[model samples]
Target: MKIHSIEAGNFKLDGGAMFGVVPKSLWQRTNPADSNNMIDMAARCLLVENGDRLTLIDTGMGNKQSEKFFGYYFMDHIYDLDSSLKKAGFSRDDITDVFLTHLHFDHCGGVIEKKKNDFYEPAFANSTFWTNKEHWKWAIEPNAREKASFLTENIKPIEESGQLNFIKQNSSFATQNEMDFDILFVDGHTEKMMIPHITIGDKTFVYMADLLPTAGHIPIPYVMGYDTRPLLTLDEKSKFLNEAATKGYYLILEHDPNNEIITVKHTEKGVRLDKSLTFNDLFN
Candidate 1:
C-alpha cells in the first residue's frame, strides 16, 4: 500500500477558537498568530493507493460558497485539491472512494461542486462517498452549535447522486471489506468522527483529523473550543496519545501548515511531540 499526503488548501482561523481556553501566550509559541489573532491552517487530506482501490480521505473546503461567506475564513488557493492531485500523479476521477472523517465543511466540502445553474453535484463522478450512519443523521439534522459548519450544499448532493455509502458501526474500531485500513470512531469532535489507521509493513499512519488538528495541540489540556464535549475530547485524547506514544504511531496532522506528520513521546509533562516530519521525510 502507498500513501500520499494531499494538500487541499490553506486557510486562517481564530487562534482562540482553535485552541479553546488555552492562553494565546502558550499556543502562539507553536502556532504563532497574526495581529487579528488568526492562525494558519491546512486542509491536508490523505490518499491511499492499495491495489485497484484509490481512496481519498477528506476533501478540503471547495470554492463553492459565496465570497461573503468565504471572506470570514480567509481561504488560500495556492495548493488546491485539483493541483495537489495532479502533482501526486492522479485526478479526481481516479478516486474510487472518498472517506470523510466527518461532515464538517472543511473536510467534505470539496466532494461537491456548484455549477453555473447553481445546482450542486458530486465532484468525483466515479467515486463512492463514505460516512458513518450516525454522522449522516447528525449532520442532516444538525444542532445550533454545529449548524454553520455542516452546510447543505456540501453534503446533500452526495445522497442525491445515489453514490453515498455508510460504513457500519460495529465497535470502537471497525473494518470495511472494501477499505484497506481500519477506522477508529471518536465522538468528542463531532458525531462519529472516523479516523483512519492505515498500516504499511511495520508502520501505522493514523489520520489525526480534528481529534488532534495540529502538532501544537499535543498537550492534555489543549482541546479545541469547537468540540461539543470538551471533557470527552480530553479523555479520548488521553487514551489515544498514550497508545500512539507506546506503539510509536506516525500521526498525520490535518490542519497544521508547518508540520505534516508528528511522533509523540512520554515525557515528564505527559505526552509531548518527539519529532516533526514532512511527508517526504518518511515516504521519500
Candidate 2:
C-alpha cells in the first residue's frame, strides 16, 4: 500500500477555541496567532493506494457552502480537494472509499457539493462513503452543542446516493484492512472518530485526527474547546498519547499548518514531543 498526503487547503480558526483552557501565552509560543487571534490550520487528508482501490480519509471543507457561511472560517488557500487529487495523478472517480473521522464541516464537507441553485449531491459518485454507525446516528440527530458543525448538505446526499456504509464495532471490515493495517476509534472529539493506524514500510503511523490537531497539542491538556465531552477527551488523550509514546508511534497531524508528523517520548514532565519528520522522508 502507498500513502499520499492530500492537502485540501488552509483555514483559520480562533486560537482561543483551538487551545481551550490553555492560555494564549502558552499556545501562542507554538501556534502563533495573527492579529485577529486566529491561527492557521491545514485541512490535511490521507490517501491510500492499494492495488485497484484508492481510499481517502476526511475530505476538506467543501466549496458548496455559501459565501457567508464560508467567510466565518476564513478558508483562504490555493490547495483544494480536486486540485490536490489532480496533482496526485488521480480524480474523484478513483476513490473507492471515503473514511470520515467525524462529520464536522471541515472534515466531511467535501463529501458533497452544491450545484446551481444550491442543490446538494454526492461529490464522489463511485465511492462508498464509510462512517461508523454510532457516529452517524449522533450526527443526524445532533445536539445543540454540535448542530452547527453537522450540516445536512454534506451528509444527507451520501445516504440518498445509496453509497453510505458503516464500520461495524468489534469486527474488521474490508476498508479497515485495505491498507493492510488497522484503525483506532475514539469518542470525546465526536462519537466514534476513526483514526487509521498503519504499518507503512517499516514504521507505524497513526493519523491524528482532531484527537490531537497539532504538534503543539502534545502536552496532554491542549485539546480543542470544540470537543463535546472535554472530560472524556482528557482521559482518552492521556491513555492514547501514553501508549503512542511507549510504542514510538508516528502521529500524522491533520490540522497542523506547519508540522505534519512527529513521534513522542516519555519524560519526567509527562508525555512530550520528541522528533518531527515528514512521511515521505522515510524513503531516504
Candidate 3:
C-alpha cells in the first residue's frame, strides 16, 4: 500500500477559536497569528492506494462558496482538488472510496462542486462516500453551535447521488470488508468521528482528524474550543495518547501547517510530542 499527502489548500481561522482556552501566550509560539489574529491552517488530506481501491480521507473546504461567504475565513493558497489529485497520479474518477472523518465544511466541503447554473454535484462521481450513521444524522440536523459548519451544499449532493454509505458504529474496531483499516470512533469532537487506523507494512498510521489537530495540542489541556464537550475530549485524549505512545503509532495530522506526521512519548507531564517527520521519512 502507498500513501500520498494531498494538499487541498490553506485558509485562515481565528487562532483563539482553533486553540480554544489555551492562552495566546502559549499557542502563538507555535502557530503565530497575523495582524488580524487569524492563523494559517492547511486542508491536508490523505490518499491511500491499496491494491485496486483508491481511498481519500477528507476533502478539505471546496471552492463552491460565494466570495462573501469565503471572505469570512480568508481562504488562500488555494490548490484545486483536481490538480492536486492529478499531481498524485490520479483523478477524481480514480477514487473508489471517500472516508470522511466528519462532515464539517472544512473536512467534507470538497465532496461536491458548483456547476454552470449553480447546480451542485458530487466531485468524485464514481466514489462511494463513507460516513458513520451517527455522524451523518448529527451533521444533517446540526445543532445551533455547529450549524454554520455543516453546509447543505457540501453534504446533500452525496445522499442525493445515492452513493453515500455508513460505517457501522457498533464497536470501536468496526471492520468493513472493502477497507483495510479499522475505524476508531471518538465523540469528543463531534458525534462519531471515525479515525482510520491503517496498517501499512510494519507501521500503523492513525489519521488525527480533530482529536489532535497539531503537535502543539499534544499537552493534555490543549483541547479545541470547537469541541462540544471539552471535558469528554480531555478523557478521550488521555486514553488515546497513552495507547498511541505505547504502540508507537505515526499520527497523520490534518491541519498542522508546518508539520505533517508525529509520534508521541509518555513524559512526566503526560504524553508529549516526540518527533516530527515527513511522510517520506516513514516510507523511505
Candidate 4:
C-alpha cells in the first residue's frame, strides 16, 4: 500500500482554542497567529492506494457553508479536494472508501455539498462512507459541547445517498483487502475517534488526528483548550507518544502546515520532535 498526503485546503481558527492552556507566546512561535488571534489551520487529508482500493481518510471543511459562515473562518488556500486528488493521479470517482475519523465539520464536511434548494447532498457518489456506530450516534445526537462541530447537513446525506457503512469497533486488526490496520480509539478529542496505523515500506505511519495535532503540542501539558476531556487527552497523548517512541512510528500530523511528519524522541524536555520534515523528505 502507498500513501499520499491530500491537502484539501487551509482555514483560520482562534489560536487560543487551538493551543488550549499553553500560552500564546509558545504556540505562536510554531503556529503564528494573525491580528485577530486566528491561526492558519490545514484541512489536510490522506489518501491510501492499496491495490484496487482508493481509500480517503478524511474530507476537509467543504465549500457548502454560506458566505457569512465562511467569513468567520478565513477559508483560503492553494489546495482543494478535487484538484489535489487530480494532481495525485486520482479523482473523486476513483475513491472506494471514505474513512472518517469523526463527523466533525472540518474532518467530514467535504463529504457533502450544498444543493440549489439549500440542502446538502453527497459529493462522492461512488464511495462507501465509513463511520463507527458509536460515533454516528454521538454526532447525530450531539451534546452542547460538540453540536457545532457535528453538522447534520454534512452528515445525514451519506445515509440518504445509500452509501453509509458502519465499521464494527473491534480488538482484532481490521483489514479492507490486504491493507491491514489497527484502530486506536481515543475519546479525549471526540467520542471513538479512530486513528489508523498502517505499515508502509518497513515503517508504520500513525495518522495523528487531533490527539497530537501539531509539533508544538508534543509537550505533555500543551493539550488543546478545545478538547472536551482535557485530562483524558493528557493520558491518551502520554500513552500514544510513548508507544510511538518505542516503536519508532512516524507521526503524520493532520494540521501542522510546516512539518508534515516527524519522529519523536523521549528527552529531558519530555516527548519532543526529534526531526522535522515533509512526507516527501521521508520518501526521498
Q: Which portions of model 1 show Cα errors greater than 4 Å? A: 171-180
Off by over 4 Å in 2: 173-178
User: How do all models score by TM-score?
Assistant: 0.96, 0.96, 0.95, 0.96
lDDT by residue for model 2 over 72-111, one digit each (tens)?
A: 8888867899988987899998999898889999999899
Q: Using TM-score as the measure, which candidate wins?
A: 1
Candidate 4 to truth, TM: 0.96
Identify the candidate with maximal lDDT: 1
Runs of candidate 3 with Cα error greater than 4 angstroms are: 170-179
lDDT of 4 by residue, 108-192 (tens): 9899998887877788878999889998899999999999998878878877998998878875234455566778889998889
Deviation in angstroms for 280 in model 4?
1.5
CA RMSD (A), model 4? 1.5
Please, what are the lDDT tens digits per residue for candidate 3 over residues 1-284? 78889988888888899889999999999889999999888888999887788899999998899998789888884676788899889999999989899999999999999999989999998999999888999999999999999998988898998999988975443233534587888999999988888886678899999999888889888988899988999999999999999999999999998899999999998998899999878777
Question: How much lDDT does each candidate structure score?
Answer: 0.91, 0.87, 0.88, 0.86
Candidate 2: give its CA RMSD in angstroms: 1.5
Compute the lDDT for candidate 4. 0.86
